[model samples]
Target: MATTSFGAMRGLLNVKFFQTNFSAMEHRSDIKKDNKMKEFQRILKSLYENLIMLELYPRSQIDLQVFVLESDGSYKSAAFNAVSLALMNAGIAMKDYLVATTSGLINNVAVLDLIYTEEKKQNCEFVMACFSQSKNIAYLSLNCNKINAKDFKNLVEMSQGSCDQISQ
Candidate 1:
């Protein structure tokens, strides 16, 4: 699950556990204990993968549950917001907060958080991921057209502003 808000990322994180097989008892044939265990194992495996990433900023374990409040062109931003909020809600310590945004050049206009319609018309695409707390860029990728130095700088600035808004 994921969530999005216009403000800082600290407000959306929550952790929860739910019974996946809650209704299985009503359908006895579907309530296989082994199957449930397997599902749990898969979840654990995913958790392990996340843990490996979290280890880089280790402090505490995070258990969070998020729900999307809205959908827009910035799904990655929303997901990052959700994760950051979840960690904060769980009281996990970290060196920095990460934020992400998508951008593209459409009809020669550089646009931030391009909507689906804009993306369809765009000739170039990019996503910028940054660490807001540290003011450091973590990732940048261009999909089609090459961004020259000037345009790259503008994109970075725009993305940084988006990150600042998210981290605040």
Candidate 2:
């Protein structure tokens, strides 16, 4: 679903996404010109900033190139996983494995790793990433019209469980 390359270059943390068509169709351009793509890039960069030990490489830059070959729903999570593994492979210093997952309430039931269709069917959605070893949250985003406390709690639990599974 995703592949990434990690390099030490000249800027801080620079992340670029390629094959826009495969990830999500957008206007044909040499670079991703869509607002959604830019937002995705920002979110991914923030996620990396949270997990990576940036202080260790003060003068060096961390360059990550992510190519998304396919996506249904939760492609950002795939990107997170890809970059995390690539960082480890490249021997970059990281606090921990940043495992991510998307979960939502479908008919008031917690569901994990929803597909495109399942995403539409869900009432509320949450994207979360955490330090797998420490079980500490690194990032969390929510999108829901309205949800009760019980349902929200269940969704968080489900999301964390899925992240743990992915980490393994």
Q: Best candidate, lDDT-wise?
A: 2
Q: What's the number of clashes in each of the models?
A: 5, 0
Worst 10 residues of 1 by lDDT: 9-18
Stretches off by above 4 angstroms in model 2 are: 1-11, 22-33
Tens digits of per-residue lDDT for model 1, 9-32: 232322442233342223323457
Tens digit per residue, CA lDDT, model 2, 1-168: 111323433227889875457554333464534666778888888878767877677556788998777667777677778889999999998878798888888888888887878888899888888888998888888899998888888888888888888888
Best by TM-score: 2
The C-alpha TM-scores of every prediction are 0.56, 0.79
Candidate 1, residue 166: lDDT: 66
Query: Which 10-residue window of candidate 2 scores lowest in summed lDDT?
Result: 1-10
RMSD of candidate 2 to the truth, in angstroms, is: 6.2
Candidate 2 colliding pairs, count? 0
Cα lDDT over the full model 2:
0.78
